[model samples]
Target: MIERELVIVGGGPSGMAAAIAARENGVKDILLLERDQYLGGILNQCVHTGFGLEYFKEVLTGPEYADRFIKKIRGLPDIEISLRSFAVGMTGDKVVTFLKPGRMERVKARAIIMATGCREKTREMVHIAGTRPSGIFSAGFAQKLINIEGLLPGKEVVIVGSGDIGLIMARRFVLEGAKVSGVVEIQGQSRGLVRNIVQCIEDFDIPIYFNHKISRIYGRDRVEALDAVRVDENFNEISGTKFALKCDTILMSVGLIPENELIEMAGVAIDRKTNSPVSEELNKTSVPGIFVCGNSFKVYDIVDSVTRDSLAAGKLAAEYLGRARA
Candidate 1:
């Protein structure tokens, strides 16, 4: 196996920031592996302007924010980037196995940083009883379909959960000439930021039903409607509050969970509640020389926070390498 001083298992904002930090801290032979064809990850699909306010002190779109880091990574020759490289396995001793286009490779690194990001909660995860239909999509997947693939998922939409992504999509669907019936949230208030709730829902005059839940989905071949009901403080459905939301599509934007399976494969202790590594300190995992940052460690509210946390992780990895060499 090839030997590396440091290996970062993602190429999004977190991985890029960590790699850059490690290289600047005097660690050489670093490798960054990204499963996607591009390095930006989900940012590539986010065409809206709201990022980089904290880090760059300027408002930028997701792609633009990611480009700033990507350029820095390109300038650093010490950090090698491997696009379309999926890390499949990792060992407790820092052995990482990944797959490329035509070959599989392994690297034994002195230190490893996981920046694997987070995954969206789907319809099944939320326990929305529904037929396996065509029109249901996660809010993030809808963003990709609309912004990346240039495909409209549906014409009439009922968004479940007023999470940031769902709120954003409510406006996006309206902008694309689709009718958004309303945003349904089981909680008493929206789960998204104040700005998102204002700009995406309130400003657009999109109705949001608080204390409401999607109890069931109605469809034959595609989404036709949804059974919406109000819930009490205990989340039990309220009687006489059942209603039908006639729509062709359902977008779920409940929440995000950290992607930590790779670290778990490495014998790292995980907190069952958060599904993240059990770290006593920021970015420091239970296993020595293994670090985690960004959404893989825990979902953050903004990209700027992810960058800051990842820079710290990179510094920690560099410090670990220094001790190993000593």
Candidate 2:
């Protein structure tokens, strides 16, 4: 078992920001663990612009924003980052067990930050009746495929949920020579920001159907088409409003849920509404030495908020360590 003054459970924007903040605030011996092969987290796959406006006073892409902080963290000699490290569980007394490339290791930390981030809800989670086909992709997954892997998800796409990711992907699909049929939302209005709606869907001449949802998907091995139906406020399908849309892909941007299995294992109290750790202090969790911020605390719409929230968490965690030593 390795002992550290601070252990951050993620290496994304929140984890990186927290480690930087804690170090600057006088804490040393910081260790950051990331499950992915890289340290940038989801930002590495987000290629479009519009990030870093609030934090950097300039517009940038997701990777650019994450890089700004990543470079800073790299220069900190006291911060240790472990890539491809999957945190399996945590003890109530603040010991964390993680699996690395060749071996599993445990770390006892004076203070812990849960910045494990969030995961997108898939087709199964939304209960859409459909053949389990190959053309379905979550908005984020599709983005990663195109941006990181240089692969196209489909030639024709129907995006469900008008959230920011869905809107962004609609434009991305169009840019990639794919035909976007339209974006469907079950709500009465679009859930994404007005700018994204205009810049991505509206500006691209893509239609957005409010109060509509995919009723069924038809295909044997891959997606060939799907049925969309208008729904009432109660989310019941309105009779005779179903329409068939020809598309090879269906991307769901329904919602995101915080990855909190480790939080639960540590016996941290979670907020039922947000499905994340309950904040007891400024950025501290119900567990005295445990803190949570960014998407792990709540699903944030933007990366800037993640960084700001993490800075507070890091500072508060440092204060906690100080008090413990005193």
Compared with the true structure, all predictions reach lDDT values of: 0.93, 0.90
Which portions of model 2 miss their true places by more than 4 Å? Answer: 323-326
TM-score of 1: 0.98
Error of 2 at 68 (Å): 0.7
- For candidate 1, write residues 1-326 as lDDT tens digits: 89998999999999999998888888989999999999988889888989999999999999999999988899988788999999999999999999999999999999999999999988888898877778999999999999999999999999999989999999999999999999999999988899999999989899999999999899999999999999999999999999999999999999999999988999999999899999889998899999999999988989999999899888889889883232
lDDT of 2 by residue, 1-326 (tens): 78999999999999999999999888889999999998899999888899999999999998999899889999998999999999998988999999998999999998899898898999998899978888999999999999999999899999999889999999999999999999999999888889999999988999889999999999999999999999998999999999999999999999999888887888988887678877755567778988888888888888998899899888888888883232
Measured against the true structure, the TM-scores of the candidates, in listed sequence, are 0.98, 0.96
Structure candidate 2, residue pairs in collision: none
The best candidate in terms of TM-score: 1
Alpha carbon lDDT at 232, candidate 2: 92
